[model samples]
Target: MAKAMRTTPLGGTRQLRRWHRARILQAIRAEAGISRLRLARKLDLSPSVVTEAVAELLAEGLLVEKPLPPTGQGRPSVALDLEGECHGVLAWEIDLDRMAVALLNLRGEVRARAVLPPAPDSLSAALEQLQAATAPHLSGVRVLAAGLSIPGLLEPAQGHLTLAPNLGWADLPLLERFRAALEALGLNKTLAVVENEANAAAYGLYALGSLALEHCVYLSLGVGVGSGVVVKRSVYHGARFHAGEVGHISLDPQGPPCRCGKRGCAEAFLSLRRWQEAPTLARLGEMAERLAQLSAVVLATLDPERVVLGGPLVEATGEALLRLIQAKLPRYALSVHAPEQVALSPLGREAALLGVGALAADFFMEQMAYEEVS
Candidate 1:
């Protein structure tokens, strides 16, 4: 048998630093072309601290100073924005029977994108196909990082997949594979991240300005139902990296079993796969009542800023799902009747992919800061 390759990411300490730096960059990224003074004010930090941070970032080429016009008035203010040309972060969305890749500049604006052939039977095969599809686009432009969103228990720290139910991926070194692939293409310098598809979608919603409410909840209705929590504009991955595994939250101990070894999870009750098994269950005329029970639990318990429902089925059912949730919600669910905030994601299909792009770009900027500071 071939010796098992070291699947885990090398340099553990570097990975930790990269994560810390990513968080810092996320904070500084809110404003467009922010001035040093303005950033300090917005972030409520001392001017000296801001200057130090900005100076280091500028040295790293992560940030560039926007030209300030000559105004023969008072002191001119210098604006800082992301340096897009420095590197690009790619986001891959691996869905059922389809593979999509998007190229985003360091500022998180999408530059270009294309779809790849859905041709693979195993993890290695899929990565190979993805590499082939991404080859032409990988020329010259520094694709220094990638964020992969797939349906599975993704071990981000290790850049490995604990399990991918839909695609039969298990214990695969997802990040390292991408790294190797990029290196093969002569684009060697980069970071690779694997995130749960649902959590990624929630973070995507936050980045896109749709789920603007600081305290928001996102429900990703897919082969399995997954939910995400955003408190104060950040995605909390939790201690065990399973914080938002809401699909496995037990709604009934006697109901169907979730892939994670739980029974009667919200997913079991509302999973699209479950509906597919028995088409009659999904027909609007028949299962309306069951969908209501399942949806209402999430709405009433979370009582979030808004309950956003996405994923293909949710998008297809659309407002009908919203109405069911509203009808089931107690008349006194919240103070004096603000119309039910249940909504289908307007961003639709591209939401998860864009979210991963934003996250990877943010990570790249953070690494630059650490490099400059060090």
Candidate 2:
């Protein structure tokens, strides 16, 4: 078993059912418009089992049977898809200076969104404000779950936020605090999850179809770095749910030291904080040599289909980074075609926020599927 932790009051049987439904929903989610036969095969479940689960999900308005388009062969097979408005997921995405809350439906549409000043470090006040921001849209929409995307590390299994390092908060009991907040708002939710900001952004990339390839590495160059990896269309959240912490990869053994107590991590070179610290680093062109050097190192190891460069600094110095990747990557990897491979994300600052919304909707849809099955 992979690090099991339950935050629900449901009995053992009910918890098993919930886990089963969530897996099924995730399989369907990986590929859109997949036939029932293929869905079962992908999940390695029996045809009867797939049919039963699909029937239950359809009843709960979580899955819809869509008409298959012509395939130039026999009659098109029936396909399964997520139904719009099946449920709503609320996201409270936190950053250094501000916070964003969004209510998203099952079909991944944003129905309502808001941004507010981040509450004081006290967890209670933050929860109260978020609950109120989310309450107005709850009627007629099933609220299956919500997720809190924080800038710092969260030990999701333990339900403990191991300090927002940038904000100087330490060892906060985040999940329990959130539970208290919801109870005060007259709400009993199915579940509330804690997701890393970069991981959420990576999830957003997939849920929105930015990736159409086998493997994608989502790299963020914000105040810090976070990586989200998609293997076979599902997130590979390592044994400890800490799979893609690529920002900490050491680039220079002798260079500046990271707050992680390590030297030469990518964030040490590419982050906005570093760029701002050096008044001479105002133009991307000035940092072109350094950005290219870092890009070459990242590309040589990951060789991702597209190296999504985004953050405040990526814009100011994108051209410079591209040039550096083009120059040093060829020298290191000996690949003549390396320059044009890395692509910047079309969805810049919005990437992380959008991901929070998607994960929330996914949590709700799967929860509903399990309830209907019971």
Candidate 3:
């Protein structure tokens, strides 16, 4: 005779249920229009568990079921998708020359986006302009959180901009300012986050449909060159949150000086600002080769499954630069097999904003589960 299975507390069971629901919801967002049966197989949860969790999500208006045409199935398959217009996040990117604000849905799709003026003199000024610009599109929706991306090293935990040479900002308490602005705008309940622009863009590419690998590196080449490494489908911030400072990687001992006070750093040669200053075919090729060298270093160390080139420079050079990088990769890759393929980001300038949306969406989902279990 077998002993009876141990029973968990009623509250524990409800918590488990909420966790399962969160996972199912996440899968639905990742692979929009995924069937429950497929989600069960992918997430390795029992069909009954998925059914129960999905049912709850449907009731909560976070998910919707769409009927799929049968392909020799018993009943028409119902695919789960994030409910459009249910809720969204506010994502902002403050760069050297511009500030972009976007509203993204649960599936990381941009519902509305606005490119405001250049970086403002103060955080408050930027917030005021952003609020006025996005006011028309901000009504009738629950905003889960606000995410801000900046081109600088940041104390992310406190949302402080520690250093941004291009923008001439230092030790700016952006997160605190953002929270205060939200309170002033009567949006006190919305959470706020601040992150490095490159890291956010890398995470955005991973969370969005841009990359399909568990590990990939995103090279952001704007006023500077930085990298974001995604391991296990999450951004890998190093011990000091400077994991991918590829920009400062010294390339030439006697090369031009970088803002970080390094000579011959990759950013000194490959940055968009540098390219713009010396726009010539020869310079473009040199920059492209340097980019390839950076990619080689990434492959040699991190060995990610894919490498992505992004930021303002990539957009400017487009296919010409992409081909140069690809052509030069074989020489530097030093791999027995073909090197990891490098691709341009589909998210373009909006990558950071979408990335914040991805983070905010996940945070909001976890918040939902917490509220339910509590």
Number of the top-ranking candidate, with lDDT as the measure: 3
**CA lDDT, every model vs. true structure:** 0.66, 0.67, 0.79
Off by over 4 Å in 3: 1-11, 34-52, 66-78, 337-340, 369-373
By summed lDDT, which 10 consecutive residues of candidate 3 come out lowest?
1-10
Model 2 lDDT tens row, 1-374: 11111233255655555555566666666677888889778877688877877787788787778778887888788988766564666677777656778877655677788887865676666677787777776677776677777766677656688767766777888878766765665657557777777767766776764556445667767677766765554556778666777778777789788889999876676677767777363445435555555556556666666556665566656666666556655554536436666656666776777776776666564454344343
Residues 209-308 of candidate 1 have per-residue lDDT tens digits of: 5456655667787677767666666666778777666677676799778767888777777766655666562454333444455455555665667667
Q: Model 2 clash pairs? A: 292-324
Q: Give the C-alpha miss distance for residue 62 in model 2, angstroms.
A: 2.4
Rank list by TM-score: 3, 1, 2
lDDT per residue for candidate 3 within 292-312, as digits (tens), equals: 888888888887887888888
List the candidate 1 regions with Cα displacement exceeding 4 Å. 1-28, 43-61, 67-72, 117-119, 238-240, 248-282, 285-291, 299-303, 331-339, 366-374
RMSD of each: 7.1, 5.6, 5.2
lDDT score, candidate 1, position 150: 81
Error of 3 at 46 (Å): 5.4
> Among all windows of ten consecutive residues in candidate 2, which has the lowest summed lDDT?
1-10
State which candidate, 2 or 3, has the greater TM-score. 3
- After superposition, candidate 2 runs with Cα above 4 Å error: 1-55, 64-81, 231-265, 274-282, 286-288, 315-324, 332-337, 361-374
Model 1 per-residue lDDT at 284: 48
